[model samples]
Target: MVKPNRPQFTDVEGLAAMVGHGDAFGVGGHHFARLPVALLRAITRSGVKDLHYVSWAGGLPLELLLEVDAVAEIDLCFSSLDIFGLPPKFRAAAESGAIPVRDWTALAMIQALRAAQQNLSSMPFQLPQGSDMLARMPNAIAGPDPLAGTDTGFIPPLRLDTFVVHAQRADASGNVQIIGPRALDFAMAGAARKVLVTVEEIVPVGALRQDGRQSILTRNQVSAIALAPGGAYPASCLPFYVTDYQALSEAFAAKDTVLSDKLRLPSGGLSERLQEAAKVSAETVLAMPAPAQGDKKASVDEIIAARIAAELDNESFASAGAVSPLANVAYRLAKATHAPDMIIATMSCGHLDIAPSPMVLSLIESLDCETAAAHAGGDDTYSTYYQAGAVTHEIVGAAQVDRRGRVNTIALRKPSGGLLRLPGQGGMADVANMHRDYLLYIPRHSVQSLVDGVEIASSARGLLTPAERDPMGYRTGKALVFTDLCVFRLDQTSRELIVIETMPGVTHQQIRDATGFAVTFDAGCRELPMPSGDVLAALRNRVDPLGLRRLEFVSAKERGALIAEILAADRAMLERLIAAQKSPAAS
Candidate 1:
């Protein structure tokens, strides 16, 4: 795996000198700026280049973000907000008809590379078989050999010459560690002809091996490692350090943020922000604990049983009767079981007040990011773990469900019209495919949402038929349909939907009445526990005051009763504990 010794560049300027003017550069994840912003700006400003990116290029990494400093410019497609880290200016530029907008999915790119690595003629992508996107990139979809008959026209394979990445740490020999989902980062390493890595620390070859199989990134594919301390500063994580959530949010919010801004960023602006953010003190940040180490994994059977219990007891939390029981269950489960090395949670984009804490901070305080990311899943760094494969479990909100355990987040039938639609299908398709453990977080028993079978044709884009079942050996590894009243999981053998647990207030009949299909109920379903009074207070006072806020909306009676009942129940539990503690006879 020894790389041929090649000339090294000392700085961004030196690196730019080697790449020369007008050369095309492929960045690993266009989610945001990864390279020095200064170099990106310089390259784009010269106006002597063609920049091609494999990411959705219209948002955060917009061309104007680079052009502001006269750095560099790129002309490419994939201009929708669907691209993970695109800046607003980039989207506007595409809308302005300045740059071409190409529609493509990350999966398509990954599969293309997979096809290339395997030396296939071309890969058959599932979606967009007759898509408008295919019409634009005829060459991309058209295989080199027309006789091959493999292209499905949804998305074509992407071939790149070089890929640049920023890592938290890398050995001198090039093994790297990405603390979270370093999306497409690995694929890029394997797909590209050359890989350039900039890292915070350069460890000796033996240092990375000390961790054994725990190493998230292997260095053999790396062509170069630049000891750029703070090199990925404000852009990449250094493990224990804080993720600049505000900076990323602002970058997403800014009109002109772009990949060039990230690549050739001037140190001066970020330095000041870093200093200000650092005023919070390193100790505060470091206090966050990593996921409590040494906890064992919860077996699939164990998880099914727990969900049953949680569902049975869900009423305590749903009714605002005392969320402590629910919180305690989560806390205890987290404490007792080994958390995944990575976890992903789908959160709504709005509602900043409850946004999840930074990953580093979560590691310090809670040791997991689910609750935190649930609040901030819409933030720029959302879904980073999806590409990284660090997340073993992901909880997402679903709009509908079927008897077969399939869930849908978008596109349902409307009372007025035959179809009601959101913007379009999105990451759910990928998340459903990727998550080893998938939990659908939704309120129980929505009359309209639970479907007996697949409804609309929106996802006909990549529909896998029933006959095609288990073709890939991917059964939804773990699924828990969480609702206000009950929780359900797919049976291992049948994949038939099964109710594992019910809320304290909800009866089996109630659940049956709620679901559209005949649900197989656990005859001995358990009830969820009541949260501790203290945890209930924290949740009521801090986590959620309204109790019903997490729900889309609740009636006045619903809110008042749910809140008062939950608080009173917790108070009752607390008083009993206090009385027991005070009784000397008991002692």
Candidate 2:
């Protein structure tokens, strides 16, 4: 698949030349998958400065860009390193107010892009009726809704000077082939004035015709194509390699804030790095062993996951945002066991209606995204599900949740009467009200987390009654709270969370002691119904072989060890899968 210089092929310097200083650049990919990292590196290496960096899911790519002070401002929904915690650069910049920022909700950010895509000055999004997003930003405008009578919010278009994205492969003719999740690349490509693509490999002109899904972006849409193998090196690029987690984790734990030399690739270094990534990805791992067979004593994490999975029936539709392995596992387990027809969308938009695959963070985008039926952007997902009120279930986490079902993911109150900044609400604010079922899970069920009241309600479920929701074309939903100790459901009449069921060993007294507000149990309360033997088997063997569900439950002190174990298990699994794929019978 060696590519000759046809019209689209360009060098790294040439690709970087297309971008200018102080440009509103739209970046593609969700979380840590298929990011045009090599292209970003090239831009920074070329000493481009004062960029208005834009991203739907701003994480590692944002960090890399910010490392060299390339970004003077940011427009993104959320930024975090997932399990490793908040991105250091983003946190520092945000805390110090060193850079201008436009923190957006998932809906608002996508709506802006959709506006640009449709050639509109502004696009109408669902009004955040119960969310404090408008109050926080003070920039969103209200649009007249003559049709439904419900207030509609309009987001100004986020026109991009340049858009950068990575794909699995592209031909010399600039026909890009993305094997797994397109995420927001197609939308970004439509919204940008110029599209710059970095491909893992360059095939012949007709080679991409083998699959229609690969040919979505035409040569006309692309401004230039660059030859960069292992472009999304640290991130997962399906059909080639998964995330190099060891390198990423090392970066996470590294004291140095600057980008690692491994990531800051020279022109010739990319090929060598790609080869090393391939060799390391499939190598046998021995640090962690599989859980023992057939004895079905469930851990607290397994019990919670099982209980959550049981809530979903065959008709259920579930969605979970990024960095949520527990919810991701539950959705997959439910679909694999009883709820085979249940639809699941995870990693925000990267994996939609995904098939049950091994729950390894390293290969999440690879395995899950590849098996998914469809991938969408923020706009596509919100329009179809959130705005339409079509999603039946969404498992959202909270930093602080009150007895009134209000959640705060924005900031925490410090004892000194200041705010301890937390990760901003990444559409949890919208989904809390919009989704048909508000499923809140808190791994830690302490008094601090299960608060009496939230200082600021970043997200709260508002449409509990038909009178309020029906008139607005919204879904009437109830909040169900899942914790390590007990399960609570919002008493619709009271609009207050009451303990409905206790975990296997948890007692009423313990629940009362842990809760911040006065505790009341439901009249029909019973113990949490444990999963069936078949369900447990599906979880252990098929869905979560690496025990990734425990990630949410582990402590900050214990997280390092748990991540190491999971990574080792992930490498081991990849080794076997790759070997199986290469087997004679598999071929």
Candidate 3:
């Protein structure tokens, strides 16, 4: 029934063949949405070795390839499983020095792809000067800008040999259409030598033209198209499905079976295996108990959120990036309480004037607000707004913060040659540099996190003095550090982190013992004002009634116990089914 004249129509094998060994492959998707998982699975099954990968927000595809030893090198902005937690295999590979990785912020990565697409050799960017990223990346160098007459950092173009993306629909002529934010897919497709697309459906030739705006890539840009429905699998494909978070969480919790048993099918195709996995996921979720409820008192996450919200002034325009659920809540709470006119931006290309109701775990799913406006253009447009000083405030988190308020979300390299890679600086570096002023939020406080000096400075005030920072386009430097135990601000003279206030019942000794360096305080250090009953009510009853904040603090041991309980329940059900089948009723 299909036409053979369509050059776009191809099998997964053909898709895999297009990407040769040692070629740079640009993968499309953000976190979990619209990933070309089926194609990646095919490549893994084909035993294709020594491929290099470039991604914006790396997740399942990257982790799977690492598991099977398919990747030789990777270039990424951030690599994490998002709400599902860290990717075990990717961490193991990076920490063990089995693969080489080059890190960039989300904006930098997107700009690099854009530069390649426009056929430029490199692109100038405003990055945090004197950050450790400058040292880690050889291609990223400071040079005199011909236009500005001042030195600025530049990132070299990342040319890809092949680019792969999954979409909602595509025509036989290879016109690809995406429903939600395209993220980096368009730029990546343009930057690559070959473009392969997998779509949920193959429609008539003119079907995609009906909505010209949604059609991101033309026939000339795309080389091959395959019908790979549910290509993203556990990840969501907007307009078709929400992310199967329950399934993905279970798969991540049961790490031992994810690669060998659930993902890789022995005989059937990738599509079939994915369907079976989905069924299993649904059943497992149904069998499990409901999430545990929290006590009547305010959770640590709510307290953190409220404190961050209290910092915002009226007319503030803020942006919160991925893995920042608490910050997202803070934005909403700010709008609802004090800053009624505050504008909040989400990574999913949405702008909300009104706070979202019953906050979801992921901001991408919080698209139902009455006054929300969608920015269909994606990250490029968002970055432009950030660069233009439209974003007045930003809430960013870090893996490490030094005495000078420098932040590091990259890796901690050990003398033993193993690297402990935290999720790389997503857009934190860019936000910290571009925004007028920003607050740094750290949920957990410890000696390792509040360090004497960060092992790697992913985002920082840098060595520039306050006088120099103004001319360099930095409006304010490291305004505040909000942590569980206390609030810190940088000292004006020494630029050292100084504790200004402590949470109720927290002692000076406790703060000192937790910090890696000697603690300093203001002359009038005071106890933080406790949240009023009304504020606590707003956070509990309105903001997050489901108590999703518990997910952030759930220990590994607790997760293991939950996983064990699920497995035990599943085994009991299977045994009961087997016993029923053996009974002699009909026979």
* Deviating ranges (above 4 Å) for candidate 2: 1-8, 264-296, 475-477, 584-587
Off by over 4 Å in 3: 1-7, 209-215, 258-295, 348-355, 362-371, 376-379, 413-418, 463-474, 559-587
Candidates' TM-scores? Answer: 0.50, 0.90, 0.84
Where does candidate 1 stray beyond 4 Å?
A: 1-7, 17-25, 29-42, 45-48, 56-86, 94-98, 124-156, 169-181, 202-225, 249-394, 397-427, 430-587
> For candidate 3, lDDT tens digit of each residue in 1-587?
11133346788778987778888888886667778878888877777788897887677888877777879998887888875567788788777777888887666677678788888889887765547676666488878899877877788888888888888898867777886567778888878888888888889888876763354577778888889877776676655554555466666767456462354322433333233222222223223333333346665677777888888778687776767767777877777677877777665443334344445332235233223554344456555676665676777777789888889888886667677778888767766756666578676789878988887888875533558667755565446888888999877677788899888789999999998999998889888876767777766655654445544555656755544443443344333322333442311
True lDDT of residue 211, candidate 1 = 48
Candidate 2 accuracy as lDDT: 0.76
- What would the per-residue lDDT of candidate 2 be over residues 1-587, giving only the tens digit for each residue? 11223335787679989899888888887676778888888887888888888877678888888888889988876777887777878877876679876667777777777788888888777666666677565267876777866578888887888899888888867788876556677777778887888987888888887874453677777888898877886776766666778778877887755574556544544343333234332112222233545756888888989988888989888987877888888888888788989988876755688777666556566555556787666666777777788888888777799998888876676787654666777888777777778898999999999988988778888677778778767677657999999999987889899988999878899999998999999998899877777778878877788888887898878999998887777766665544544452431
**Candidate-wise lDDT, in order:** 0.42, 0.76, 0.69
TM-score ranking, high to low? 2, 3, 1
Relative to the unseen true structure, what is the Cα RMSD of model 3? 7.4
lDDT of 1 at 568: 49
- Determine which window of 10 residues in candidate 1 has minimal summed lDDT: 314-323
Model 3: weakest 10-residue lDDT segment is 277-286
RMSD of each: 12.5, 4.4, 7.4
Model 1 over residues 1-587: C-alpha lDDT tens digits?
Answer: 23344424245444444343333355543333233333344335545344555432333334433355322344233332221122345534444445443444434555666555555666654333212333333345544335555433333345555556666667655577654334455555566666666666667767765642122456556665566665544443423232343344344445554544544334553443332332333233223222231233332223322442333221111100011123223323332232222222322121111122322211212222213333221212223444333334434445577766565433455676554333222344444544445566454366565667646322211223333324433333456677766777766566567887776667888787777888787776786554444433333333222232322223333543443443443334333323333452331
Q: Residue 329 lDDT in model 1? A: 31
Ranking by lDDT: 2, 3, 1
